[model samples]
Target: VSCIARHISLTVGCCWLDGENQPHMKAVFPTEKAVHDHFENLLRILSYEPLYAQIRIKRSNDETVLVGSSLIYFLFIVQMRNMDWLSDLNTTLKNTMVSIIDASINDEVAMCCYGVLCEILTDEESKDLSISDNICNYFLQMLEDIWNKTKKKYEHVPIMMLLKGFQTLSKNDSMQQETAVSNRIHIFIEICDEYPIAYDVIWALSFNKDIQQQLRSDSPFICKLTQLSRQPENEQMSKIIDGILWNLEINHENRSMTDKHNTKEFDIMISYSHKEKVLCKQIYEELIKAGYRVWIDFDQMHGNVMDAMAQAIEQSNTVIMCMSEQYRKSNYCRAEAQYAFQRERKIVPILLQKQYKPDGWLLFIIGQLLYVDFNKYEFSRAMQMLHNELKVELMAETHTAPVRPKEDSVVAHSTTYISPPEVLRSSIVSENILDWTQSQVQDWLLGHNLRQLSRLFAACDGRSLLYLSKYMKNCEPQQILDLLEADSVRRLNESISLIELSSFHSVMHEKKKRLPSMYSSNT
Candidate 1:
């Protein structure tokens, strides 16, 4: 602790103006003894009332500011040792850190102290082990706010130090396991935007067995990063930025996504049929009035049935599938079911009829996962499940998971619906599969007009058709079906972007001698 105290000013090269034209570095601390005294006294006070200690340090004057360093080290020790102080310190430290950040400080000594303070305060280790929902939530938000405020000025030690702090904070199993890992990653990516240099800290930590092992669970972050990593270096960097933004938006959205329809702020998509529309719309309005970014077919799909539905589904954080008799009777509902199943989006099936049981493929999915039974109209309990799901998704996206499929992978559940054994026989189709180009797929999506998707969906029916049309409005669904039905080579190529084609193809080719011939005629 004392060594850190003396090394601070010297390493930072503190300086200030005087009467001379030439600038000069400021004087180092008076003595080693003074530095030790400075550190010891502060820690003694912090270990007393963690919260109050932070308040004193944050509100102190220049003469008393040394308490900041003490508070910083105190938090570090608490985190490294996995002490009980963390739960209490997390709350008080967050409040103190915010206040200190907002306070004006012109002195180099004070700034140096601030840098060390942030470095210790934001340690990801602090987030580990003991889970407290309120503390994790507050800490996650603070890290995000600090990252946004400091990213542009990352050259400063204080800012760089904060990054380290966050890295340590993320390592704490208590905090890391709490679901803020994704948020931490998001903030790191946001700061690293266009400048990969900033990723050094996280990249290093990512190699840690403890960190990587913890992040290996199933999560959307894993899927998103895998997808982002395969893009061209330039685009990969940009997508890193996008990944960060996506997590932030998702985390923020989760708060309301889980709330009851009457209380939720966002308008979530309700994937149901005309019969379930009343109940579905009720949930939708509930989410909307509560302050969410809800997407329904009525607002945007009018132009193209398929495109609208696809757009709404893709844009939504949650998809409520009302499982009523009418819902199953409609092919449209089945199509919507297929779409949600493929995307691996959050799908909550509310079984309205007592006799109806989700079986085969749907049962395999919904059964393995928990869902709300609406046969008896347990509105309150159903809404609670939605809230819990929303929270789980947010946490999952924040921490990078290993099993979630990357974007380049075949649409997750596509294989369930599109069987390749039936489409491998045509020679022209087989050859096309071998020749099918990813560049062609990119060109197709980029070239097609998004506005025309609905007209093409007119041939299909239901919510699923609507969902597809929304995203692929420019491309004809028949062409997509045709492409999908072709040899595996063609389908594989279409699934990934041209920029990522070579690498992915190489991986696939290494695993198998000849690429499977599946869907080609559609291309």
Candidate 2:
């Protein structure tokens, strides 16, 4: 019986029951009855537990151990595929799994026990079992054990499963104490070299606000992670480091942030990543020399910095976003852009990444605004265009009265009349997308959930938008965004006399790609 159970478990569990593939597999084969049938058969097999499970007596060692190990794999994988199965499991079966973990002396049986425990305890809604101090301590103890075995080649699968439960488990009272959270953080760091997934565990832990605050207070810990980010082993590792750094920024000592939200602020508020500090500083210097008051957080802000940013935005007239992949990744930067957008403040985005463009939340925030691409234009020219959009008058057309023929001119004296070319008015909203005035584009954006981006479309009619969609059909999502941004600024230059260059929304062009092929036929 044990030999048969082991063979069935190996074929079914390893080949047919990988957790990640189950969701799509179930969707394709919508026969839930098949899984229910498997569940019934598995429970009947578990009904015949060894004598040791009932009376604490030793059984025929290897045979019973193999059967028990294979049975628990069945439980774990089934629970993964149908999570509700764990909650439906009876109280006796639940205790049996935990009991196996508590008593198993063999490493194979112990690993299977950990796997089942991970499936069971990770779900907080499992009414039969909630995590306690014992369970939390067990995960920490096992992680410590893994770290302590210097020369042993132990399985890292159990460690990963334990971290999954520990992640959800850390939210309850069992992990409320600072020391418990801190210890897990340390152990994850220690084991990260051998088990690189350990870094992911630490990153996940940072999502809890309280734990994020705790990590921020530990200056040395934040400093160490920052150093690690500088020399990441790979792109995935680089993203992990960026995510951690984005979450737990540094805390400057001996300086409590004052209530500057109500105070007098600069005319232009500069929001950029510290990675672009040199460029940000130059922008700040030039703005200052031009006599425009500016706000750039020259001193790197660390902890609890959003409040002052809100206040600064409230008092500022213009916000200059020095955008890059790094800036978009920061929660702090996103918050600032979002708040500025919410207030309907004018935004001027200057792209900093070589080929990067915004997406998701960042994309929505800068959608309809004038985009200044530093990568495409020379520094002096980009700044000059930025100034023209701001109405600073560098190469800007000065509005003047139209020159008319003299009173005695021959055309003026003649009775013959002439007709001039007809131009579309900015206020007109066309039925066709191609003939659309920019103002109509603004109304279309406002009708959507995009209040942050409603300006800068006064001159971009349906043809401009259609061409933009066709031109960007093959480009990446990011490239399309940046290209459209540069195109928005180019449109702004033509309408500089009447343009305000105010900011936010960009989903329309992307949605345009999905339009019927007939829409392309009109042009």
The numbered model that scores best in TM-score is 2
List, residue by residue over 503-522, the lDDT tens digit for candidate 1: 33343344233433332222
lDDT (C-alpha) at residue 256 in model 1: 27
Model 2: per-residue lDDT, tens digit, 43-148?
A: 5565454633432223345455444545554544544533344446645456666666565555545544544554444223232354343455666777688556
Error at 197, model 2, angstroms: 1.9
Worst 10 residues of 1 by lDDT: 414-423
**TM-score to native of every candidate shown:** 0.25, 0.39
* lDDT for each candidate structure: 0.40, 0.54
Clashing pairs in 2: 368-505, 433-462, 434-462, 438-457, 453-504, 453-505
**Runs in model 2 with CA error above 4 Å?**
12-40, 47-63, 71-96, 99-111, 122-131, 150-182, 207-221, 228-239, 251-523
Cand. 2 Cα-lDDT: 0.54
What TM-score, to 2 decimals, does candidate 2 have?
A: 0.39
